[model samples]
Target: MDFLNPNYKVRNLLVLNAAGFSCISLVVFLLATQPFYLSDVIGVPPEKVGSAIGTLGAVDELVAVIVAPLLGTLNDRINGWAWNHSRFPSGSRILELVSFSVLALSLLGYGQFATKLFPDLWFWRAIFAVGVSGCMSIVTVMLHEVNNSDFRWSHMAFWRTQFKNHGERLLDGNGELDTDNGGNNELPTVEDDVFRIEEGPTQQTNKKHGSLAALLGVSTGLGAVFSVLFFLTLPVRLSSWYPDLSSKESLQLSYTLLGYFSAVCGVVVVVFAYDCVKQRRLSGHTPDLELPDTTYFELLKQGLDASRNNLRIQLAYVAAFVSRSTAVATAVFIPLMVYKFYYNSGLCGAEDLQNSLKVRSDLPLKTSCYDGYIFLAILTGVAQTVALVSSPIWGILVDSKKLGSRATLAVASAFGMLGTFGLCLVGRGDVYDPRTATCFILVSLLGLSQIGTIIASMSIVSSVGQTVERTEHRVIGSISGLYSLCGGVGILVITIIGGRWSDHWVFGPFLLLGTFNAALAAVATRRG
Candidate 1:
């Protein structure tokens, strides 16, 4: 529980991971809600709103593609060259703090612009995306390196063995192991007890890694909880904080607060986050090689080559691309969809204005709180709550069983497709009452799928990164950077097209989600 205790590495890791992911969730939550503000408060049309928001994200991704690799490679060099000189030998920790601050300021800048305290500029918002991507890149690399250690591997092996052995017994309908007698009769199954028998690259690499599922679950759960709470109470808090403020100003103030919180959290991480490289040095694992002279592009090329050749890596990347696109689209479009379909927009009167002032709607000066917006917030919160509850379970399955990323991703995709398709149907419904009930169920399912996709894809990337480190002798930072780079590409591809698509059809993004998830399922069926 005491993450500052250096002796408690697991606790430290759990806390650090959670804090890092929290920043990401906050940014994403803000982005998702911004569409409502743009359309309702700023008087932007739905089409333009989606397009503009998508463009903002696209700008971030474009920058991410450039920055992630460069920063990752730079970290490797810093670790090699400045290990003795730097305060935090890893360098990523400092970068993470800086990125978080950048993200925070960017959010504040957006708020300022919206509140007419600053000039309207796309550049400021784009900085937010860049900060997010950079933070993600650094945190991911740190996770890979810190996780790939001998102590962690032992933890994973112990749990995996216990789970696998117990599962085998359960399948055989017996409690005891077979000796001279034949094994208990069970369904035909292929079992890989390779971790027990062979010192393959996976086992070797895992020696440095801990229970990845557990780490991932705890981190993602924290993020989910934070996002849900922050967003759910945002309107109420904003309204309470500044009673006389206009709706735009109120919302902008809320975002500014988000930035402040994120920035403070980032400062904490910079001060207390563990230094994995220094820890390795203390453990007598000193690197003999000097910093690589390779250019950033060349290092990136190596990462790309490894991913291209590794089937599991390629599939993981693609699945992440699809899954993340779905998530981003959901965040940006779902509230807008609710506004279009479920809200009682016709109730725009003096009484409604007074009601809205009390409850708050997405639109400016609308005192009538749209039932749809509240419902969407609740739906989103419920889904995130489910994810927080289920993350640990999914994490255990991924780490302890032989389910692998492929099976996990396939299952997640099934849920994603079903939920998205259901949402599409719900959106098209003629009756609001029935649709409301169904919307809750579909959105909840989507949330579960979101967690599943995250855990599976993350596990795959971590495993692949370790493999590349061992077999290719490449820096895990560079490899992890590549994983993030691929994800950035996914965001770009979806947001650019999806924004336009949503403008045309209210259910277009949902349909697209269903189709993409279906494709993800197909591709993820490959060995991963």
Candidate 2:
């Protein structure tokens, strides 16, 4: 079958979208299950398990900072060669396929090796961390490829506008329309009326592109649902076939299977999916369009120079990264904290805790103190979906200059901080009864806060960058890497402190995290 047909670009996009969702799901699922698997299945102590997990975060952050920029630069230098080469040359697809294969193999090895080797806690954790980081890089490359595709530019512009609109609403719970006295209609100025006519075709094209993009969103959402279901069911299916296996062994087997499946899927997409499509287009009698050959250093210089022109862009990057770091801090130790302090509370005894841990070990799943973590995960997924869907809208609004990115970021940061504070207070209140309800509410609030922050930060980043004619792949990767690095720092701190004091003082870490997040929010808002 012809793989390189330009007409098949939409198909490639669907594949990329699905791959992106799958990659994220796999990362989050593994992360959520790691603590439980290490402590219960592998027989590592709770404290050590926390350290091991924290170390992974630390490693991922460090690697991201180092790798993203370099990889981005490489991507820039090899832009057309990697993406538009007529033949199967060393390009983005090759990098993506190799990285994904390594990631999947590493994960599978960790799962199977844990059963036999019982390697040092940190060793296994580091392997998984590095694997996920590699996968993240590949995903970023794929995102850039998708963005640069002919079909995606208009969609990106629309989403950018959507994101800005969402940011405005988040900042002040209203759309762009003015609330005039008695809600009377306002007449458009002569310039506004003339400009509207001039931009009519562009607006119509954007609307058409947006409608098509919504179909892709639907596909992505469905893919996520399927991926989650597959993960949830894999363990049960394996356990039924291997009933005599230990819980740990079963969990390891499940992860290994999933890893292998993900790797195979990634390889197929990189090889026969996108690359083939590109090649087919080249072989046809179609005219060879000029693809830009921008270097990474050039893009970096442009971004840097652009930031100099607009100080707000630089501040926006810092604010967004800092806010993201603070927001993610709670997740670092929450798993370990729940396991040590709340898992074996009055409701669930040591035996039940052990059994629950065992079950999770057999499957790629983890349940925290009250299984509230699952609820939290669901809420987070929903919020992220909302933010992703609204991104284009926000971008459009920013481009139109209806609202400022700084103001939007500040308000979102404030709301997120407030949510963290609320969670901290609830944790301090010592309310153990109705555990499910309380946990649900807390997680929901966190999800809401996260959604606001996600939208705001994305808007700010888009606003700060230059509109110069060049590929933005490297800049996006570098900024994302920096964000990951900050998150890693936060996770490292939480693991060190929370791991030591969780057993003796449960509330201390929560209180500290809340305070830290609030303080960071204050700093971000001031800078914004």
Candidate 3:
């Protein structure tokens, strides 16, 4: 089947989307499980768990924001060189491979360190951040490369055909030349040309644009669900399978298994993504690639200019900032909240708590901490399931002329605002309380909002990136780099401040999320 780019086949696109799944699954698994590590394995106090997770994340996003821009431009340079030089796998693929290996190695090292060597954990996290940034930045560029001026590469190729004969021998619905024009072989009128130009993009372009958006949305949502559900449940599953191992031991075992799975996926990337970028097949010639070289300076300038001049691009970046923080940060914080409830209420961890001097061994081991893992898994599972179900909703909304891209974000941001603010009104999560159901409902709402923000922002960016690519072949790396940078800023702000606030109020991170979405809603609508 044909996709957006003629050079790359549908299989390559599938491979690219699979890489997204692989990277996101690993990253989400890390975020989902870290709180358990801090609260249980390391025996951090309940109040301090939030701060420790936050500080670690602050460092993660800090390194990410710094490296994203540099790697963004560097990716384009590597692609440019590869385009002109060799047929080997491009830099982005290599980047993805290296990233996956590094992330896997980081996970493998996490639990192996003795308690005395725990301070060295910071160094590994920084390494993990570099791997994550590389994966994200490269994926951003691939998404950008999938389109060019909203199907200009394909549409222009059609328009560049023999216009006069095309008009004279207009095809019927069955692809045969029609004689229905009463044998008149006149060229298309100026009015016809104007209509084609002014009627927005071609229907073919629209179809591919919406299709790709839907595909990626579902891919990401499914990846998150798979990671959260599967990895979060591993501890309990392992405990049941290995009765001799303690819950802490089960958790470490799960982490090690994830590292092995990630390494296997890295091997898959090398096999499939070795030579994805092909020479363009436009106008039966290679004039597009034969044009003047796109200097790094010009490419970088185009990215800055797009951000400075275009309101949609700016909104897309803002949406990325808020939406990414919403996506991954909440994965950390929500499970962290649930785990905290279990720890405080004596539902789990009598011996583990005492080992760290959290509490005296009083309540006789009322329940296993793996139960907390189960609940954490369930809550996140619900959120991502909702995201997967709602992924298509935003794609349809963005594709609609009546609602358009901007209006979709405006409406979706309202849902995000409602969901995040709604969390503030709910009590700290208790598995037994009737109010716990409300937490699920709010999480579902946020799930809907989460997928919306991503689809809307990505659809807009892809279209805008296409427009920019028309003037210059490779401006997307810098734009996507900037996109990651903004997201890093969002994570940095939410993690640092929300971590401190959680000590005082359990719902502090949700409150911050509500504010971000509220501001996004206002700006998105104001421009409309």
Winning candidate number (lDDT) = 3
TM-score of every model versus the real structure: 0.79, 0.66, 0.81
Candidate 2 lDDT score at position 266: 67
Where model 3 places Cα greater than 4 Å from the true spot, the runs are 1-4, 114-118, 148-204, 274-277, 281-298, 349-367, 428-435, 465-469
Q: In each prediction, how many residue pairs overlap at the backbone (N, C-alpha, C within less than 3 A)?
A: 13, 30, 1
In candidate 1, stretches whose alpha carbon ends up further than 4 angstroms from where it belongs are: 1-8, 84-88, 114-121, 150-211, 289-295, 342-344, 347-373, 429-435, 465-474
Runs off by more than 4 Å, candidate 2: 1-8, 80-92, 115-124, 137-237, 271-316, 319-332, 346-405, 429-434, 459-528
Query: lDDT tens digits, residues 1-528, model 3?
Result: 122243333344566678788778878887887777765567776768788888888888899899887777666666666666545456667777887888788777665652322465566777788888878777766665564422232323334444554454456778776543321123343322322333343443553454466668888778888887777677777777777776667777777887787778777776565242443322122434423256777667777887788788899899988887787545877877777777677778567667776655653232367677777778888888888888777778888879877888888788888788888776654432312778888888888887888888877777753432354335667777888888889888998898788777767888998889988888888843
Clashing pairs in 3: 149-466
User: Which candidate leads in TM-score?
Assistant: 3
- What is the Å distance of residue 332 in model 1 from its true position? 1.3
Q: What is the C-alpha lDDT of each candidate?
A: 0.62, 0.47, 0.69
lDDT of 1 at 125: 62
Instruction: Write one digit per residue (lDDT tens) for candidate 2, span 340-430.
Output: 4444354324446667656543333322222433433454445445444554553343334444454544555555566556556666544
Q: Sort all candidates by TM-score, best to worst.
A: 3, 1, 2
Better of 2 and 3 by lDDT: 3
Error of 2 at 390 (Å): 8.4
Model 3 lDDT, residue 519, Cα: 87
